[model samples]
Target: MRRTDPEGHGPVRFGPPLPADGLPVLPELSAVLAAAAPLGGSEPVGGGPALLEAACAYWARRGLSAGPERVVAAPGAPSLLLALTAALGGDVLVPRPCAAWWAPYARLLGRPVFHVGTPAECGGVPDPYALLETVRRVRDEGGDPRLLVLSVADDPTATVAPPEAVHEAVEAAVGEGLHVVSDETWRDTVHAPHDTVLIGPAEMLPERVTVVTDLAGALLPPGWPAAVARFPEGEIADDLHARVLDVLTALGARVAAPVAAAAGYALTEPEPVTTRVAATVRLHARVAAAAHAAVVPSGALARPPRAGRHLYVDLGPLRTALGAHGVGDAQDLEEFLTARLGLPAPGGHRFGDDLGALRVRLSTGSLLAGTDTELEECLSSPSPVELPYTQRALITVKSVFDDLRDDAQRWEPPR
Candidate 1:
């Protein structure tokens, strides 16, 4: 019953799909793009207030003190983060196994990024005790620790910080006077509404935090670039916002007039698109649940996912059995699954997990398609019997474990 790895013919998608909702609405300046089509004619300057205002309103509605002036629109979150790192110009701290972009973002700017281990329950926010120690260790090494960037509802692990955990992390940062940048790119895709608390980081520490979000993750039709960072209140925030605008101007990072119109519309009216995104969340929960059920001991290595749209399966317990299958580590397991089960999950190495440890992220979103019709159908179906792709994925993963158990028995010495 040895599981044979399935060969991958092309790219396998297992992440949130950008909603295919129609073009966003922009009533006032619909003529901006057509008129400025010639190498930037008028283009409506000042970073587009309607766009920023919409972003601010969205955040404020979420209980964040995101004033319109504090809203800084950029092409996307990564660019704005790079600019902020440059302007702040000090030591930055991030949790280990973060999104692949964080390391490169720091490397490109020649900024040092210190990685601290997160709690076993989550992956984005660092363990509070470790946070304190890391801060001391960094400053002791002669680097001024000024900012802490955390991704609530993290990308790789797909876990969200509990409200109390969020408060705890911020309290530690406050003690050290650290400015916090919370990336909420995946906030809209939480698997369970009540399981995740959507309090912006600014709510936890207003004067010390900035929340960065973009239409890239949850909203449908993300071709256009438009993102907003809700900065802290006060003169410092005013200065930072101005600096962001200056950098955007220098880099020509304005969200095109058409995209801004669309993004503004989406930000203001997100119910329809959000309903579309929820389908992915439901799919993740179902697939994860099936995988958990398939485990021989049911919870031996698989823990229930707390939030987000992915599952982090630990293989430490099955290491010896997996080794005999020629899967020695996370990479081997990833390859085995992709080749045999037709799953293309990223290995632990991608997220800074221990190389030798057997842990990999399983994104259940592979069931998604580019079309709204398919997405709509997936959303409406509840029972695994309804969606064939999602059901097949669950079965394939379950087959892996069934093979693992059978293989263990075969490898055992005769009694």
Candidate 2:
């Protein structure tokens, strides 16, 4: 089949392909396709302000008093975040090992991103004490230090801040006059009771915080591209909304009629889809746990994933062993595994992590193996034995773990 690279080396397959149901063509969306379609020249050039109001009302019912004027809708959260970067008029502070998107967003906004230290428990929100120091240093360097972007229930790390940590972060942001943007995209995917705090930005810093959540993370497909942001009541709310509209209008980032309609339907539906999605989340949790367990003896430590789809493993403990085995860095290890181990993982470097840091984000979504029919069957089953692809994935991953474990050089005693 000539699948190998041009060099004729062994073939490497890093990860699984995106799923069908995970895309936007689900039954719920299909139902709303035409009804939610946006009329041409829809008076509001950017977004339907009325639709923004409805979303705000929806979020308010969920414990956030979102003013419609402060609410904005866009094609996705990343676009809105870039607008925030422009509006805040300063450098953005993001924790290391954040989503791969942040760097591009920051670059697009022409803002320098300060990679801050993450809390021990989470990946996006900075450590409180470290934040205090970093803010001062940033100010000293003449940066505006006006914005903080936190990906709560973070992506790559799969850790959510405990309520107490959230409280601390809010306090720090407020103290610094830093406008906070809490990216709660993965809020709905939380698995454990302690895995999430239902509080929104309005609950934390009613005046200073802006909440932007891309329903794409949960309800919609990745390419579906529709998101809502809540701006708290203030004079700047109207300005921010207008600015958001401006960006959308210029970028032509309006949510597609069919996708938005489908999203609205999913939001209100009292159907089995939510249950189906939750089951998928549970599957991810299981795969993450299994992967963590398998790699534990190999010095790959994962911070018990609480929410979201990926498990972040710190391979630092085995760095020396891998180094001896001629693995150059985390990227090198990712390359080696993709080639030798047939596991595709996004390198830690993609997430603004240290180049040499032995961290890798492994998404278990590959385990959702099967056709749409098979997936539906699996979703319906009490405990579906994973299909062939998933079995291959587990075996391949476990073999990597087994290899590392058997190699005496890889083990490191916990301090």
Candidate 3:
């Protein structure tokens, strides 16, 4: 339990392993890195003009207008979030099941993180009524609730919060005087971008929200850690932006020179980077759907993944079968499923869900690895589900859960 945090080891906590994508770097991106690798120095404390401008352009394309001065870049989202948490001091309220990496940074700042229950429609934003109730309850309990971190396109659950839901949450947080930090890292990875109405919190509360996006979420490889945040324009926001830059400077969290160049290139939406991300998201979406299909018939419950490379499921219905195998809580379920499926099945507790809940998040990347042909087929094929490797992966998920269903039936007592 005392082991280093899986997301940010600096601030130690029990975090689930971040999903690993084994795909090779894109050729165009590789060319960019190869070209930039020879010219070396750290970027400026808050990012150089080129990178900042590139980020501004990226945000503008997403319909949130901002200048280069309002954006800040860090080596990774965790470091950036750590700086943000330090700059804005107060207790944090996160949704019940959020990205596993969000809380440690708050804890690193010695801020208590409270989990508000989320609406059934999505995993990231808190239920509006629950949000209001929790804020008042925390104040009554002597907590200074000031920051609320949320995601529009979430990890684990892979649900994209609807625009109306986002508006309600923003209204509640702003009404409560809490600055919202919207983690829009998955915005570009929506399985159906045109159909899904992705709204950033900054769009809802212009002067009271900060937008953060990790390049690794879609635009760049995970090894090249780069993330950018956009602070809304206003006098108070300007001062807060300065504080964040100072914190970044103090922590020496500047982006590496080559990575900054690559991130800049990726953010500009060149055809190569755009195509690769679209293809990858498509592959993951199909695989996630297959996994969801396999589990549901066996009594496991999951929302259809709308974005990202993972799906969250509740296996509480199969708890009777799992209990027979000494898998009682979330951790036990995690260990059992990871070993059985030969993949990382991070328990729900890793994302702030209750310890007693039998739930886990399964990464599509875990099942997407194989021979070059198989991997290529997965990336480019119209029906990846027809491929042998893809079918085998789904079969494995179905077989395990189907067996559990049988076990549950066997253990049931006569009525």
lDDT of each: 0.67, 0.68, 0.87
Each candidate's number of clashing pairs is: 8, 3, 0
Task: Return the lDDT, model 2, position 374.
Answer: 70
Query: Model 2, 383: alpha-carbon shift in Å?
Result: 2.7
- Could you tell which candidate, 1 or 3, scores higher by TM-score? 3
Models sorted by lDDT, best on top: 3, 2, 1
Task: Between candidates 1 and 3, name the one with more favorable lDDT.
Answer: 3
Ranking by TM-score: 3, 2, 1
Q: State, as a TM-score between 0 and 1, how close model 2 is to the true structure.
A: 0.87
Q: In lDDT terms, how accurate is model 2?
A: 0.68
Q: Which residue segments of model 1 deviate by more than 4 Å? A: 1-46, 221-224, 278-280, 291-300, 369-372, 408-415
Q: For residues 1-415, could you state the per-residue lDDT of candidate 3 as single tens digits?
A: 0211233221234566555555678888888888999878889999999999999999888788999889999998998889889999988888988999898788777788888888889989999899999889889878889999999999778999998998999899999999999998888889998788888888878999999999888998889999999999889899889999989999999999999999999999999888888999888888889999999998999999999888999999999999999988888898899889987788888888888889999988887767866687678899987788778878998899999999999999999
Across 1-415, the per-residue lDDT of candidate 1 in tens digits comes to 1111112312233322322222232232234444444554222433477877888778767877565677777766777887777667787788876765555566567777777778877777888888899888888778787878888788677677777777888889879888888888778767688755756577777888888876766653455566778888888878877776776667677666666665676677555545555655566566556655665352237556655556667777676678898987666877876787675666665555656767776766553443555555666777742466656667677777777777766776788
lDDT of 2 by residue, 333-383 (tens): 667665755656766766777767777777766545657787666555555
Clashing pairs in 2: 14-343, 14-344, 15-344
Candidate 3 lDDT for residue 387:
80
Worst 10 residues of 1 by lDDT: 1-10
